[model samples]
Target: MFLRKIANAIGGLLFLALFLTFLVQITARFGFNQPLPWSDELAVILYLWVILWACAFVVPEKEHVMFDLVWNSVSPTTRRLMRLVGHTLIGGLAIAAIPASWSYVHFMAREKTAVLGLSFEWVFLPFVLLLLSLAARSWHGLVQAMNNRDLDIHEANP
Candidate 1:
């Protein structure tokens, strides 16, 4: 619950920042006829953070896009098997990519954004968080499958 609150707060704050930055950009460009150099870049950065953060923390698993035709048709035991296989593949791939993702993000530290001069490493760090979240969620799903806690297709969809 605490973590959920934190995630919601972060997601809200990022969106607010992005919206404010956009307003500032528009006001400066059209109202004052003097555009700020950093506003666009800042907006882009905030947009990226907002999207990736939502994907990683804010969005519920059931809300994600899924092709559930087969899933809906399968029996509970078959669904469990599917969940196990799917989560295992997803979690395994995410875990495998973490090291390389970390290396690339670390290497980007030397590069900075054009206007903000903020390290690229900081900008791209959310990607690592996303990968970690994916793996964690997959693990959770795997565990649920093992425990025979599969959600009905109707429940998941509706």
Candidate 2:
């Protein structure tokens, strides 16, 4: 529980910082006549981090998009079975994606962003985190499906 709290706190801080920086950039660009060159890329990358981290942070809350009307109408057993299939497919995709994204990031490391001179890894790191988080979340969903009793698709608090 404590660890979950810490993760939540860090996620919140990261999101807050991302938005604050974007606001600052917008203000500088419009409120004043001067705009920082790195603001656009930095804001986009920061938004990526928020979305990636939010995957782990949000799924436990059952907040991701779902076809709830359809899901609710299905028989419980069928729902569980479908859940396993869906989660398995998603997890497998996540596992497969890590290597390909990593390779692209590595290949681009020699080049720098036009504005920030940032390594491509800076952009790709969020994708790695996103995929890993999906893998973890989907695995948890699979475990719950296998249990086949009182299943909750939320990721474990850990």
Candidate 3:
């Protein structure tokens, strides 16, 4: 619960930061003769982090996309089983993605982008943490499904 609050607070700030970056970029382009070289680049990078970070906070809210038509068609017990299985797969992917991305981020630390002139690792590092957080969230969802306690679950009927 404490961790979730921290994630939410961080996500909210990141979102605001992303918005501020856009505003700054627009202001610089219009208000000044020259635009900031790294504004859009950093904005884009932060946008990615905001997205991935938002995912962790969202999963508990059952915000991920789903194929409801198929799941709705199944029996209640079957539906529950399928939900568990699907969440397990997602959790596994998040788990795998963390390590995979960490390795890539580590590799990128040795170099930096030209315009941004910042270590790519700094931008990419959050993705690893986000992926791991997602894994944790998905695993939590899987447990909720097993206990039939998930409130926002969806299913496909066909």
Candidate 4:
């Protein structure tokens, strides 16, 4: 889908930025004998964005870690039931945390990073996006489970 492509693009861009930041940090530290103070902070922030962004958007559901000892042993009916219960729990918890997460991110507006002086809210905003993405993904899973789709536990994507 178009949205998925955009998400992938964003994730790729974030990773590229993180790589460039590290290159800058390393080059300055060794080549110039003077490390940039803000580079470290920027790198950390970009790393966080890259990881959470990948998890929330780029990665597919089947690619995630699964304790499949039970899932693999289950029947199709049981697997559907498990999907329903699992998605419900995950989506419910993610939805429940949204308000608190938003509040904390908003409250962090006054705080700034040590070296970059970037507001904490902007730094932490990806967390909110992650939570929202989790909830949305779970909802989609729930719907698919209800429709009896994706009940089989495949070893790999075909």
Task: For each candidate in the order shown, give its overall lDDT on alpha carbons.
Answer: 0.92, 0.78, 0.78, 0.91
Q: Please, what are the lDDT tens digits per residue for candidate 1 over residues 1-158?
A: 89989999999999999999999999999999999989999999999999999999998788888999999788888888998999999899999999999999999999999989999999999999999999999999998888887556347535
Q: Comparing 1 and 3 by lDDT, which wins?
A: 1
**Clashing residue pairs in candidate 4 (N, C-alpha, C atoms within 3 angstroms):** none
Candidates ranked, most accurate by lDDT first: 1, 4, 2, 3
> What C-alpha lDDT does candidate 2 achieve relative to the native structure?
0.78
Poorly placed runs, candidate 1 (over 4 Å): 153-158
**TM-score ranking from best candidate downward:** 4, 1, 2, 3
Give, for candidate 2, the lowest lDDT window spanning 10 residues.
Answer: 149-158
Report the C-alpha lDDT of model 3 over 102-150, residue by residue, as the tens digit: 8899999999877878899988777787777768767877887778875
Considering every candidate listed, which one attains the maximal lDDT? 1
**Residue-by-residue lDDT tens digits, candidate 4, 38-152:** 8999999999889889999999888888888998787888989999999999999999999999999999999999988999999999899999999999999898889887676
- Where does candidate 3 have its weakest 10-residue lDDT segment? 149-158
- Per-model TM-score, in order, reads 0.94, 0.85, 0.83, 0.95
Candidate 4 ranges beyond 4 A from true positions:
153-157
Give lDDT: candidate 1, residue 96.
100
- Candidate 2 deviant stretches above 4 angstroms: 58-61, 150-158
